[model samples]
Target: MKTAICYYSRHHGNTRKVLEAMAGEGDIDLIDVTTRQVVRLEAYDCIGFASGIYGFEFHKGVVSFARQYLPEGKPVFFVYTYGGARGNGAKTMEALAREKGCLVLGEFSCKGYDTFGPFKLVGGLSKGHPDAQDLEDARRFYRDLVKRFSGGAQA
Candidate 1:
């Protein structure tokens, strides 16, 4: 299955690290939302939205891109990195994707090195996170999703 990940990784590039690990598994497109404002997503069998959480939400650029360019009824997944643990980090992105008439696949999130806001005073939180172990976990997650979706596409 052809897969694409539209992402915005800023600050420490923590989110990008995970994505790079997944992409290293091969056949995944990583579209940087900051540079590419518009994208053609129709050809992809599965789409992923990724970012470093800002204000406990996926970056606005990602949200806005989904609102504007996400094709309806496509399968969607989310990948996010956050400093602090939350009950459901992908809730906002999940709802938005659902509203766009997409099939919600799954989500993968991990701790990122965060120095945002008050955390900055103390240096940072989750330092060296989204580490080797985290990246391996992310790769496994992506592989599973690909395995699952590839079958459906073939069928």
Candidate 2:
């Protein structure tokens, strides 16, 4: 299946790190929403939304990109990074995808080094996160998604 991952990774690039690891595992197209605002998703069998948590949600750039570009009835997955252990980043993205008629496959989330706002005063939260282990886990998650999607599973 032709897969594409549309991501917005700013600040410490935590989300990108995980994505790169996933790419190493298999062939996947990575599109940076910050640079490329418009992309044709019709050709992709599987699509992924990825971003870092901001204010307890997925980055606005990613959200906007999905809202504007995601096609109906496509299989979708999510990958996100957050400073806090608890966040609704993926949930919000899932809702948007569903609203657009995309089928939710699964999601992956992990802690990322964060120094946004007050966290910066304390030298950051979840420092050194999205570490080697986290990246490996993301790769595993991608592999699982590939297997599941390729098994003739419908959205």
Candidate 3:
């Protein structure tokens, strides 16, 4: 199946590191939201929205892309990197995807080095994260997500 990952990875690009590892092995298209506006999402059979958590939320660019261009009824997945163990940002994005009438196949999240606001004071939470293990977990998550979506597996 055709797959696309549109993401916004600012700061240290830790989120992008995870995506890059996954994309290197899968037949996926990667789009950096900073460089391109997603005008069309219907071109792919599956799309993955990814970003680094910002203020306990998905990045503004990724959220806006979903609001503006996520195609109705298409299968979509989510990937996010956050310093927190809980994935509140991913959940928020999932809700938005549901509101847009897209099927949420699955989601993947991992701890990334935090560089947002006050986290910097603590030398950033989960420093040096989206580390080797985190990247491996992300790849495994993406692999499973692809199988579920392409193989007609259930949630």
Query: What is the model-wide C-alpha lDDT for candidate 2?
Result: 0.88
Could you give candidate 2's per-residue lDDT for residues 37-140 as a string of tens digits? 55899998889999998888888999999988899889999999999755676988889988988889999999999999888999999999999899989989
* Local distance difference test, candidate 1: 0.88
Model 1 ranges with Cα > 4 A deviation: 153-155
Q: What local lDDT score does residue 118 receive in model 2, on the 0 to 100 scale? A: 88
lDDT (10s digit) by residue, model 1, range 1-155: 68899999989999999999999875889999878655899988889999888887888898888887789889999999988764457788899888888888889999999998899999999999989999999999998988877777432
Rank candidates by lDDT, best first. 2, 1, 3
Compute each candidate's TM-score over C-alphas.
0.93, 0.94, 0.89
**Alpha-carbon shift of residue 13 in model 1 (angstroms):** 0.3
Candidate 3: give the clashing pairs. Answer: none
Clashes of each: 0, 0, 0
User: Model 3, residue 91: what's the lDDT?
Assistant: 77
| Candidate 2, superposed: residue stretches over 4 Å from native | none
- TM-score ranking from best candidate downward: 2, 1, 3
Say which candidate scores most in lDDT: 2
